[model samples]
Target: MPRIELRTEIKAIKEVVFDLSRSIDLHKISTEHTNETAIAGTTSGLIGMNESVTWRAKHFGIYQNLTSKITEFDRPNYFSDEMVSGAFSEFKHEHHFEDSNDGTLMIDLFDYKSPLGVLGKLADKIFLEKYMTDLLTERNRIVKEYAESDKWKQVLTK
Candidate 1:
């Protein structure tokens, strides 16, 4: 399994950061590599503790329907989601938010493993590791950008 951790400071409300992190629609806004569509449960609204949802997404040129369960959730503080069923052998992600002097400090922790046992290791060494990391990095960058913008400010006000 590969674990990826990223942290960023954003000039935004903690609630906003937390909310955006759990928003299915915002997931779409944050990445181009993954085309995600919400298929079940509430998709466009705020998600709270213990919420579960299903999404169909295309990744690595393969379409997979993933069902996620919210394992941990604390409003404006932290939340975690784990894949119940999906393409990967294991998938889990945690998002944390803290009140900072400037605004919010956000941290993302991702852990996942490829499907094939030995073959996955080889694939990871060749390109999958870097590719996946880069994709997550881009997702964080885009989310951070969006969260710090006036558009997100408007979203919070609504």
Candidate 2:
């Protein structure tokens, strides 16, 4: 299993960051062309403690459905989701938020193991890990932009 952790400083409050991060609709908006829909559980709303959801999304043009359950939730601080069913053997994502003097300090911890033992590790070392990291970085940028934009707030509010 490969555990990836990324930290970023966000110029926002904990609540704002948490709200934006927990917003599945906002994620859909940020991802833009992602053909993903919430199929079950607390998919569209703010994910709370023990909430779970299944998502059907097109990844690299291939349609896939993954089910993830919220194993831990502590608003404005930390939350975690564990894969119930998906392509990987096991997957868990933990999001941590801390309020700093300047802004919010966010940390994303992703741990996943592939079904293909040695080959999976090789693939990850070669490209998958970096690709995933890049994806998360881009996603964070989108989130930061949206969260900081008044226009985005207006759109969501309306």
Candidate 3:
């Protein structure tokens, strides 16, 4: 398994940052390059505990569908989503938030196992890990952007 961790400090309210992080609408906007869309289940708005969402996206010239459910949640503090069905053998993404002097400290802990045993390890070492890291980083950047600006109202209101 490969684990990727990221910490982002955002100058915004903790509740706002938390909501933006779980916003399906914000997710779609951040991943526009991947053509990601929520195809089923909690397709829009904030995803809560036990809710699942199936996303269809194009990656590496291939289209794939991944379904994940929010397995754990604690408002404005922490949450986790686990892969229900996807290309990965198994995966869990944990989101953590803490109060900071300026605003909030958002952290992401993503742990995943690839399907193809040895080849999967190779993939992670070669590129998959970095790819996933970049993807997560960009998503966090977008969340920070929205939470710190007026853009958040558009997402939270809907």
Instruction: Please report the candidate that would top TM-score against the real structure.
Output: 3
Q: In candidate 1, what residue range of length 10 has the lowest lDDT sum? A: 149-158
Residue by residue across 57-147, what tens digits does model 3's lDDT show?
9988999999999999999999999999998999999999999999999999999999899999999999999999999999999999999
lDDT of 1 at 6: 83
TM-score of each: 0.87, 0.89, 0.99
State residue 7's C-alpha deviation in candidate 3, in Å.
Answer: 0.4
RMSD of each: 2.0, 1.9, 0.5
Model with the higher TM-score, candidate 1 or 3: 3
lDDT of 3 at 156: 99
Query: Which of 1 and 2 is ahead in TM-score?
Result: 2
- What's each prediction's clash count? 0, 0, 0
List per-prediction Cα lDDT, in the order shown: 0.79, 0.79, 0.97
> Alpha-carbon error at 70 in model 1, in Å?
0.7
